[model samples]
Target: MLRRGNEGKKPLKEKIILHYDILFKSHGDDSFDTPTFWEEFFLLKAHPDYIEKKFESFVAKDLIQMKDRLNFLFEKCLEYIQCDQPVRVINALQTMSCLFRGIHSVEVGDHGFDKINLLVGFDMAETSMQVLLRCLTAGLTNDHYNTTIKAVILQLLLVIATGTDNISQNTFVEYLMTNEELYDTLLELLTDPVARSRLGNDTVLLLALMVNYRKYEGVNPFVMRLSVLDDELALSCLGSVISSAFASFNKQFVSKQEESKSSGLFSTITNMVGSMFIGDSDEQKQMIKSNEAILLALYEAIHLNRNFISVLTHSHTDATLVGTPPHTPGGTDDESVPSQPATPTPESFVDASTTRNVLSTFLQYTSVVMQDTKLKRNISSTKLCFIILTCITEDQFANSFIHDENMSFQVCIHKMPMRHRKVKAIVEKPGAPLACWLLDLTVEFIVSHMMKDLPFSQHMRCLGIIHRLMCHEKKCQIRLSYNWRELWTALINLIKFILSNESAIFGRWKKGIFALFTLVINIFNMFITFGDTFLPTPTSYDELYYEIIRLHQVFHSLENFVLRHNANPEYKDVSSRLASSMVNVLAIVRHFNPKIEQYMKDNNMASLTEEEVLEIVKSNYDDLTLKLQHSLDHFERYSERPKETHFFTELVRSISEQYRKTMVFDNIDLQDFMHF
Candidate 1:
């Protein structure tokens, strides 16, 4: 039996040394023959104090003194990994984790000197590669081990892969490239919730690391795998993992809320009083770290997987809604209309599809992250979240934003580190599409950064998402048409915010403003060219009138800014494009100005006020100087503009591409993008 505390009143160092001496003296070269050696050595190594404290504090010299013994133990671990006994394999794997962590903690010599020396002295790189491959092949291919043993094996492999150098990692990755059985095993574990639970996040982390291999020397095996695997299964597995992480975070948040709503007034007061003195609890911080880890895993998965978005869209089939009038331009059927449900019912509305569930979870977690002051400022987490969102919006699917479920959340817009304004909770209308809710949140998020002097790349990411969403994807376009009023309102607010802030258009924010202008112009061009195709609601003309007037005013102001800032050569292209965009929009505005004027006169309405009329009159193209017209084009070419990729994204892509070309993953400091 294992001894409890105080049964052996000896110093841990002394116990370890004495036990080692006894084992060596008794068994010599035959130590593997004795069960006592395995049991006692594992007991000492597995001791909480030893594993946590002693191993962590061990230096290079300390390891050097026990180099021979460490090598022996490592060799034994390799043997035990390949052994038939499951208990032996588990114990060996655990022991290997402890030893590898200790070796990885060598902080004595200059920089990576100690780590390299230790790895070389123990011959860990080559031996670990062999053992790792063998374990994966054996554990996955046959019934030689159970789930527990397989999980332990992967745990050990993670430690090795994390601590070892490139050669070992490359070897393991190369093996996985062609090893179909191992790949299938990983996929099975990802899809099987029970198996995933048993394996924990280790499997997910392992696959994430594998997929992150961006060697462009040849075909990327993981990307190749994406082409071969079932799209639905791939999306379902990844989406489930992401959802589970967010669910855990939501549970904690909900629990905190529930604690405030205790059974009675006294309990509520007690909880409130306790909360005043307490900071973020340990559990919440742990969940934050867990969330960061899961987000990083997802970042790696999507960053490296080529078909991720396609798989995301493929998870849901195209279906239409009943009671929705068919969208026809000029009273003719439009081919751009996607298929819909013939009869809309509660059952039809409950699209518990994989893609919808994943996006819903994203929106839910985003609300939570924005509300929490600490998480709101977590640049890495926030950036990763937006990057994922940007990828999600790259493709449009059927009923992309329509959901029966309610999505109500609050966003706290912070003007400073400690000072914030809690915007009113955005409660969705009974049948409001998810697009409106998402737009509300996004607009609030962008508006929050308008006055703050911070990096705007993440804000640009938000714009990119919206830009892609507004693309001519039929399903998304048709659905958004119904919510055009809400869409126009949100977009106008964003345009007003961007243009009115002089600082936003001047220096660092200049490029983002240019991109924003391009996106807005694209969206504007779409509506102008296709407005007739949408079903004409009773308020369509009125909505279009006000929006066109708003656009006319905004663009006129933008044109005035361009003419005033003509001294800077750097602003030439954007100024020219801005002028071109204005020319296109103003022509449309001129055509509608008289119609709106007539409607207001006939209805005796205040809709087309004198101030709005003056704004439209000033928007005439003939008012521009001849020199400006000579420099500008009458029409904006609707060519395929390259998607707005971030500096951070471009940096990652370049690094990955270079690594692929040279078979070397460069040491780049991506701390800005990495949370964990």
Candidate 2:
């Protein structure tokens, strides 16, 4: 029994030290069967003050002895796990986890540098790897273990798999991948009906990490085995996880009008499942094809939760009554009034009320679902949305689901609210403001998918979604009504973010630049077409001026980047086309706002002569050429064999090819537009 209150406080530190000393002294020879001593030691070690202040020094003084003792304890723990003694097993696992956590903390120098030299000399990685493999093997082969024990084992494995030391992590991955039995066991556990409800999300997450590891380290034999795993089996496994996640989410949050924080579990499962299909390997393609059930599950889950159609059609009856035909024009009021109720006509089917409801519900659902799944707030939601978007855009079968007359995409759009009041309360209410969700979702999609350096075709598919949304007149009008400047700022900042991060635009800078240019042009066109109707007030005019200045700066930044890279023959044509596009846009800007033209002149942009621009371009070209030649000389002198051309060289070649096929000059020809 522990002492209480002030009596315990005075001697607490002394008591902890005494406990530690006795445990070490008793187990000094690396042999101990005293459970009481071990339990006392575990409790003392787990105290926050002891762990934070004294654990490292205690372990450091006799490092060899401590390691050997830990090794013995770990072996004992494994034995305990196999004996079906739940209490002992849990305590043992917890003790081992804590020890490993301490060891990792010390090894990584996370505890500070007072004992780095002593900690570094120990081979903790080798011991950790051995223990990790043994635990994994035991967990796999043991059938008597219940879900609680299995969850503990899985959690321990996660800790070991994500070890701080690279050597141990690599060794663990190698072991897991090389052992076919282990792989099969993990798959079985993931799909097991009883275990999946409790551990499916975590299991899929581990597999995702495994997949990522394999991708990063280059081809592995394990990946081939995974690919060849029966496609139907893989799909069924993934579908089970997704279904369980959705069921859990629905159970918790289905009745609430506002979303609950607990929905993260469902998001996690969907994200993991989606991540499993991110690559374009034939195996992945086949797995995706077989997993249509997952998509259907998500659709049904969303449909049941939101009931978009009912929400959309709720006000339809009221709308139809108000839209009744007016009394005959020339008749007196008494005579004009119909004897019977106004008869329905073909025109009534397309009444203002129906159109309003449809559009409202559509916008509402789109915003709400997007907010729910945005990557910034939830990776699972992001992945789920990506999967849904990809399927709708790329797969015919999934496309048909959305476009089916019975489940019309238009109906989905119509379910959303048209007025800001309805949308403002629900969309992103807990996170960002409602007005920013769409922009946030767009940026999240790009960053999550594109920044991974996936194929250009995949990037194009993502961009296509944004393009479709921006081009829709109704969507644009709705967005403008609900704080358009906020949306506009988000887009501008997104472009700037891409420009600043080389990885985001890697190997596809031309297309990225072209996309930004097109976005700016589109925004300008919106302003030109809608003008004060969208602007609404004087504050909007001020915001518009600021936006124009930002656009001018972005244009200059792109031009400079192009000029700096134009020395290469591959970039010359793209550079020229981009420059031409910039010029065309500038001409339109001058027409759209005379005040902006004067601002440009004050900033010396108006005074930038063609000769000066050429001079800047030529200087950049000379500097880049010199640098390239010097790099080539150094490589030739130092390298024994010829070095293959750099990836950037291939990137440039690809961009050149893409530019020729997709580049459009003077595409935005706003030359004919009269000034607003």
Give each prediction's root-mean-square deviation over alpha carbons: 13.2, 22.8
Q: Record all residue pairs in model 1 with backbone atoms less than 3 Å apart, i.e. clashing.
A: 215-660, 216-660, 320-340, 320-341
Q: Taking the tens digit of each residue's C-alpha lDDT, what string does model 1 give over 1-676?
A: 9767896686466565555444223235545447677655543423323453555656667667656666666667667767664445555667666666566556545444455345434346555645556676566434434344455567665654454333223333454555555556777666654445445465665665555454334576765675455557755666566655665565456555456345468644554443321115666655654465466556555555544544333223112111122222221122123334365666333233323344555566665564333343255567667776665554334224332224322222111111233222233344344554555556556655554353466666666555455453332234343456655665666666666766734566775676676566656555554444442453453455457675677766666776765566887777677667666566656665665678678879877665555445445434422222331112222111233234233333333232222221112222311221
Clashes in predicted model 2: 14
User: What TM-score do all the candidates reach, one by one?
Assistant: 0.67, 0.44
Error (Å) of candidate 2 at residue 116 is 16
| Model 2 worst lDDT run, 10 consecutive residues | 627-636
Q: Which stretches of candidate 2 lie over 4 Å from their true place?
A: 1-65, 108-143, 165-173, 231-234, 243-462, 466-513, 518-676
The number of clashing residue pairs in model 1 is 4
RMSD of 2: 22.8
